[model samples]
Target: MKHAPDFLSQEHDPRDPNPWLAMYLDRSTPIDDEVKRAWLADSSSRSRQVILPFVRPFARTLIVLFQVLKFVTPRKLAFSRTLHRLLAWGMQNFIRPEANWLILRHFHVGSQVLAFIGANSPAPVETSPLTPQRIGDVRDDLFLVHDLNLYNFVIRLNRALHAAGRELEHVAEPDFSMIAQPGLRLEDMPDGRFNFLDLQSSIELFTPIYQLLLTDDDFWRATNSLQLDETIGLYAATILDARSHLVLLNNRHPLVPMSTLRAGFRLTLHGLSTEMLHKVLFDRRAAQEAAQAALFAAGG
Candidate 1:
């Protein structure tokens, strides 16, 4: 408790695992690894700061959802992997519409509202879903998403190209075919392939970062860029646009937190400032301090 009285001081340790730094620290010494682990722990503790500001407008509604869904969203049920697999499988299989454009628009483009749920990194870069007989020409080949970041970048770039009366497909082939070189697999991520939650469970804990993904350009850029190979992760969004499809699916509203229910969900992404995130991360008694603060506020 007394280790870090000052948030700014070097002595203060934040326990948040910075995604950027966490990507490294793998080959470090055991002692150094412990140091990084502590830092990551400290970083996460103050995650509230990064998340709260964005969700503040909807905090009240979130509380209501928790109260209402307490029965419907029992933690055990929501976090159930078996249940999530069933749902995702059902979505991918049971849904009808075999056409390329229709499928692209609805599932690939639309329903991404569920991206926060977990957009499985697209199909592996090496595997092209379209066979020669299926599409015939190289241009007609089908590319599946293995990396959401590069996929998103393609989506954004397509918007720019289309706006200028150009298109990614007609532009080039072998040069710009893939979005970016295949980098670390999210499944094989550096820090034990930490891509947040593996999947959306029926009762999963809420994370604000996913919600922010809808708005944070910086977040998008950081994630989507190419790896060393530069061509593997890249893809061109010729048929459908991602954000627009999201808007259309939402009836033209994207991440607006329109209803009280939506707003309520937003509140679940609690975050902490850099300083507070680190402070609580290192302090062994962070939870105790929070409890004390709550009790004091409640007239204890």
Candidate 2:
């Protein structure tokens, strides 16, 4: 029999009744506290904390300015791309290496979580193909990208189970009525491609302010929390099934807004850090080798 991964082997906690949900919720490792302490104690982290009050207003103002520019600037001007490159360059040059590692490791952990789910879940789960280039391409949109991928994966999984007249016990059944209605097709893209640069800018602008606004424990707790995971799964199903106008006018659950905020703050902070670490540590051949080893170990 295939053994559960080390992280998932722990006895299920009553607080999180569902094993799958429990798996998603338990994101910390034994070393996380040690690494977090080191990250917090680093000179750059300490300095940022001291100056955060002064920086918070400036950051918030820039976020508003960017949101305005995103709306006003014509796509023909391609101004957003220029801003994207500039912000990318700034992040590349700044941010301490220690902090960068913690950030990159966070995504690495997320990827592993997805892999474990795919390996063990009763329903088929397909995640985005992991590649260094794809990771690099997303840049500041990494958090959003990872999230959308997971959301889509869960939607797909739920659909598969429903089709077979089976369901995962204790998991919420996502409503698929919108997709079943006549005249709607899953392939239709009524709106053009999503404006990823808008997402990138929003994340790039807000994460630093959030880092300062939240206490260390609060920040870490949010990072580890999966409070919104199921909500995101349901929303993904809804968005995929609904027409563009309905999606726009849809009534959001009370948790949806907070979920979005938490996702942006948590994922962006780690995604940017991962990008910074990639600049110095990424080796394509070595990454491929390591991936192979992981697959072999997992009995893939």
Candidate 3:
């Protein structure tokens, strides 16, 4: 398969300023290859060069802290849930609004891609739908810290895109008021209590974070290179699927620890990226055609 043109070198469409969207939407190249190429381009970009040095030390420190936290924290459901709630509260108060929008927008785009695949595919594709409550419930400090670093890159990219008279289309402006109610207690909210209204409000609050992460190169490169020593997509997909399944089971049984739920939420984002690649790369008709051609040659 032909590789996608280098994102940095290629002239971007004004209507689609984000090259990752173009990569996600492209059907000609395998999605994994497109992602890999995007990662390479992003890593070498001037933006990454400037930002990584400043972010690396903080990231390394956080990694060590995360390891220590895991070792000390009890693996109990109630205890973990309380910790996650505290973390969520911290994130809600501290993280920038722009960062929140970027994060939420990534899921919005993922939902759009899933819709597109469903419309085109002959078989129904199973998806763990992303909603506002699910997004706002995020509790992973590690994910948030990495996202903070990514936000620096996104704001710069958005500024550059704006200067070039190009803008990312299809992203809706997020409203913060919906979920930032007075006396709001994220920890107190019970499981299965969030309704459609809660979902709407959460979406308003979290969309910006999704947008920021989606625009950053390090986010893409990190996800692609996760478990790099193993079979590329398979291990990541399996781990994501397992985490998601645990979340599903928790929904039914309410037994699993909050660490599992937190891992599940982070994995959902990774899973969406994987799903986008799989949907784009696995063309059933093309596979069928290739199989038929091979069969005909073998018969002769």
Q: How accurate locally, in lDDT, is each candidate?
A: 0.27, 0.39, 0.36
Query: How do the residues 1-300 of candidate 1 rate in per-residue lDDT, one tens digit apiece?
Result: 113212323342358544535433344221222223333433343333354444454544454544455445433332223323443343233321111112122222211212211222222112212212211121221221323443554455446556667433322211222221112111121121222221111112222222222223322222232121112111212221222211111111222213333322222111111112122222313454576699899995
Identify the runs in model 2 with alpha carbons over 4 angstroms from their true place: 1-34, 42-44, 74-88, 129-144, 169-227, 230-255, 259-300
Best by TM-score: 2
Candidate 1 segments exceeding 4 Å error? 1-181, 185-198, 202-204, 208-300
Q: How far in Å is the alpha carbon of 179 misplaced in model 2?
A: 34
For all predictions, the C-alpha RMSD in Å is 24.6, 17.0, 19.7
- Provide the lowest-lDDT 10-residue window in model 1: 268-277
Q: How many backbone clashes does candidate 1 have?
A: 46
lDDT of 3 by residue, 150-227 (tens): 333334444655676753322122111111112222333322322212222232233323322222233233333222
| Candidate 2 lDDT tens digits, 180-236 | 111212122111232112223334344544334333333333434333343332333
lDDT of 3: 0.36
Q: Which segments of candidate 3 are over 4 A away from where they belong?
A: 1-55, 68-80, 133-300
How far in Å is the alpha carbon of 46 misplaced in model 1?
A: 29
